[model samples]
Target: MSDENKSKTFLGFDFSTQRLKAVVIDENYEVCHEADVEFDVDLPEFRTSGGVVRGEKGEVTAPTLLWVKALDMVMDRLIVAGVDFSTIEALSGAAQQHGSVWWAKGSKERLKNLSSEDFLHTQLASTFMADSPVWMDSSTSADCRAIEEAVGGPEELAKVTGSRAYERFTGAQIRKMHRTRPRSYSATERISLVSSFACSLFLGEYAPIDLADGSGMNLLDIHSMQWCEEALKACGDEKLSKKLGVPVPSATVVGNISSYFVKRYGFKPDCKVVAFTGDNCSALAGLRLRSGWVGLSLGTSDTLLLGLQEARAPPAGHILVGPTSEAPYMALLCFANGSLTRQSHRDRLVGASWEAFNELLQATVRGNMGYMGIYYDTAEIVPRAVSGRWLYDASGRALDKCAPQFEARALLEGQAIARRVHAEDMGFKLDSSSRVIATGGASVNKELLQIFADVFHTPVYVQDKHANAALLGAAIRAAEVWSVHTNTKLTGSEPSISPVATPYPDSEAIYTPMLERYRQYVDTIPKLQ
Candidate 1:
């Protein structure tokens, strides 16, 4: 590893809610290039009428052509940004989880439309049925419950998937189609996450779902790395389950550089297209966490991530399914409301940027909110649901009725409490022997960092450099390939360390006693209820 020997580059993109972000990095994780794409509703939007019908507030797909256009517009932005697009060797992606992009097999040339809008109109959507049920659409709980009941309830499913079934999961979405939109389910030929869809587009063939993204679906057998027959039978139409594309190892190589590439970015026809993974796994890879290290993803949803030496089943409402372990083994604790609650609600009241939102949180005095004995469990997606329980005696009761800010603080602390409880449930012992890296929207907040420090009681480090570290991590893998494909023999691998993170001592001051009360509430509130 000579300072003179600069490594080659790989490109990484995280296809997140309505956006695709691409980052290019050399072997040492240095940024060489970057770009992005955003999505508008290409599907016929549906609104929920209080669960009256199967309409269930889920928007069907937009014409495939429209999405392809959106993708190209994004690609154009990159070319303008000065990306070499050609010298890049491989294309790997991290996409939003639980999306289903349907493609029918074509002749030797496989004729299809880009999910772009230019080619298809709304009328065409009805014919091709191209929209994917994204993770944000939480309209399938009834279907989730049914699957749970058929499979023997939440605990049983958790034993296999490391997660409790959720409506946005592939299992529920597929089940919904089977029961209500039977025709569509029957007509469906293949389904893959948006990440794999990205890979498939470049492969000039069907792309397999990576283990990291597959576990989100409740259909993948977390342990065996195969689809569970019994789980499929429970959902409906076991035959349709077979159509659920092959389960590929997260690191496996898919065919490289398809016509889509030659047509879109003009990268080399011989470039490799490796397996694409989910955003969470890519984020973990971005940070380059180690065996005992933990990475917290504070996105629309919050996921507590830790790498595993091998795969393990989640006890309940928890999941361990990804190529990050044993080729892609990583466990996750996904809370429905993470930074999203703030993204949705922060504007109306605070009128602050998310960064500024943390600024205000930083201003609050710890334990000084004077609100005692009250924990507002506003969105209790994980841990125990407290329903905004009140805790305290006479003096503390005053602290119970928090202003909007207090409620805001509660949202932050409540999630931390959930993380603590989940970690305990995960059953690992952490000391100085462990390393914790905090990355994501929420982690950037100094106030939240202080609160986290108080809660975790250890120094919290922030990856303050890039907005796309996860994408850069994928690019790092590409650098690995370049080293293998062109340069020398395998060599010593070293750890990737972010700058010694600015300490969250200010957050430490804010969380002091408020954290204690929050913990007390966690223990007594559930029992009291």
Candidate 2:
């Protein structure tokens, strides 16, 4: 692309659990340059194992300064890659869903005056709650139950908020903080989800949480797209609504790039900043999924996402507001054990080598000779939520032993089966014409994807650069929002979505019994209250 075309460039950012990635694309949606800053590797001073600080009580958090530091580092790296920031016409971002960032009183003033001479973290180190609670935190079970009971029951809460009170959602987290740290809760002037916090950094002001991301908070009424009074009261703060500003549409332009970026990185002073949304919503946009297509994301938490024309809140899973500013919704099923559980198996049985793990997995037959198991590093979120490793026989009876090969195959098959069962429960049907698109870190594993195909009994599709879909999705959102800003039609044709994994002809014949066994035997598995 030439300098003239550079004026049409759009930049997108993804503040994921393990990394902060940036993707720059031209109006044609062709990649111009990309860069990333890994938390563990690049910001080692924070001492986070998985980009979060974990506690014995199921607490999980990250230093807010670490995220700020990553932004500075990533932008520097992008500049080094020859990205001309001034030419970037618009910017948007995606963040790990459900994480909350607490901004200290007067932080907006601090942000507005950021010095061009210093890095972002150095200036804004004390402007936020020292630690930001993340989606991995499960310490708020008590609060979850309280909120559910307060709203009559779990079913009622689901009807109102599109999901039952989940431990990972922001409402429970806020309630816990309100009870334990009253001073901090009172001192907090504004609370931003991870998405809006990143947006605020660029906008130099507090950004309203986008509706799509806010739906995950358990406070928004899905039907009205506003905070539910009962839900807010249950969170222990009658005034919390003011702190969590009104949500804007995902495509709304929040503001221009902050003057700090204009001076430090050469961004155009008038460059637009679109509302940032949850990473999952961004993934839906990146995939450009059509009706009859479902997406299985293999990230920190494995998610099965299906687009719906009308909203319906199911007892299990979630119905999130769509990425678009219109009526469509996205049905989502999230599993706590995704790449981490798979990595644990790989380390124990295959010396942490994907190649060796793939070899062992392929060596095993369909049912693993009657050995089946549920492998969870932590509690899961499908069917009935539970934790721990469970082994069973072909008749669905408990077993004391299983071969490592069986365990390996069971891990892959178990996840596939869980997603399939939950998707069906949410009214997703897999037929002859249905297609599955796989993304995230594990999508590159053809061996694992074959399991997905066989279990879902459908062909799995992938884009050319599927792994970075979240970042790419953010970029696309930025471009789309910019088009709305300028009232101009976007220039590029949509990218081709193609199949990368297909099931064998006998897939259903082989896995039909296994699926039935899973449905019958899962009831026998232990669960956490």
Candidate 3:
């Protein structure tokens, strides 16, 4: 290989819930190297578990500077791992959705002049409001209600913004901050979603929020792909639109890597920076999901995503502007208690071993004698179900509890059913060729994969890398945007990694009857007040 050809690489970052991770990929889309900085374990001074501070009334936050510190630590770790920064031709990233970062006045000036000698957090202390409400936060019910009413209720709001008012969304979070902390709101110079915030760190200026992630904010008019004036007014920010800056396409080349990176890490002076996007949208780009396939992510929160040729405002779930420019769209449904809920059941009933949990799940018969369950250790995003686990008999009668064997099967079945039903509501169709491509920490479990296959009556597939797809997608996007920026040969648009999953013959027969019962079960559960 020629030196010039081999010298080029791309960098992708996923500023996920608990960690900030960097992945370096070669021209061929192979993951060449990876490194991560864990928030709680590595930066204990922030005192966060899973990268969030929990408090009364369902308040959830993370120190804004903690993210900055993670960026520094992750980069230093990458340099220590012997990554050649000079080879990185371009970079992009993904962030956990809906978390907002408030920049103090003159923070951009501070960013533009970062010195190699000083740490990022050291120079940028007090640059943010510090609370930065995240996706797990549910303290914005009042804001949500007000926004819904302002926009003519939930359905109308959904039609306008692609979602009803969501507590974790940026619109509600911004309204809460604006109302409760007028001083901070007034002092804030600009607002960036976590994705744009990370991008700004690299651009040395505030990056505009990408449409893919901005759609989650409940502030964008999904149809027009512009910020909604009424939605801004509804959020109590008449001047908020200016604070938000203009939205940009997800794959747009934002700018060159900031001089800070060049001076600090010996990066190319002209290394390009692509716009960052929300994690889910990045995963969609990473998976290269076309029609007839749906991606199921089983992480801290379970999310089901499908690519859409056209946009629709479902009363439930979300429709993000697709990662690509043009007319593509994405449909998403999120469940708050994903792996954690399953892990809790595993710990309580199966000794906290995934193998043991699978054993019990395998031992139990299909449908667990007609028992169905909804497990929400915390509040759920879809259906907005009440907190606590709800179990039901075959006939849809509520039960106080079920046996351990039943519990294991029920949890898996309930989650799978929810994904299937919700995806259908969003206009996803299943066929002989349709596949459920599973990814996340839990996707590796054979037993769980089998349940996904059986419940959806579709084959379930997992990637060989088993790495974070969102991060990988960022790397892919960086490559795409780099070609445009450099005016070089364009890379292929499809995802390099393909998933492989098998289907059992009896899956359809096993799950078909249970599907009907699930509909009844959901209706019977009382809504949390």
Residues forming the 10-long window of minimal summed lDDT in candidate 3: 490-499
Model 2, global lDDT? 0.87
Q: Candidate 2 residues 1-529, lDDT tens each?
A: 7655555789999999999999999888988899999999999999998789998787889888899999999999999999988888899999999999999999989989999989999999889864889988888999999999889899999998999988889999999999999999999999999999999999999999999999999899888989999999998998989999999889899889999999999998989999999999999888888878888889988988888777789988999989974337888998889998899878988797999888888889875776677787877767545667878877777866677788889888988887887788788887788999899988899988988998888999887854767788999999988997889787865667778788888888878788778777777767556
Best by lDDT: 2
- Whichever of 2 and 3 has more TM-score, that candidate is 2
Minimum summed lDDT over a 10-residue window in model 2 is located at 378-387
Which has the higher TM-score value, candidate number 1 or candidate number 2? 2
lDDT of the structure predicted as candidate 1: 0.61
lDDT of each: 0.61, 0.87, 0.86
TM-score of each model, in listed order: 0.81, 0.97, 0.95
Off by over 4 Å in 2: 1-7, 325-327
Residue pairs with backbone overlap in model 2? none
Cα RMSDs, all models: 5.5, 1.6, 2.0
What root-mean-square deviation over C-alphas does model 1 reach? 5.5
For model 1, residues 146-257, the per-residue Cα lDDT tens digits are: 8888778888787677667776678888888789777766676676677777676567666878777787888877788788776788778868656676787766667667
Q: Which lDDT tens digits does candidate 3 get at residues 1-529? A: 5547766789999998888989998877778889999899999998997789999888899999999999889988898888999998999999999999999888878888888788888988878865789999988999998998998999998988899998999999999999999999999999999999999999999999999999999899988989988889988889999899999989798889988889889988889899999999998888777678888888878899888878788878998899975338888999888887888889999785888888888889866788888888888788786677788888878889888899889999888888787777777789988888787777777787877887787887776664578988899899988887778884444544454456567777777777777776776666643
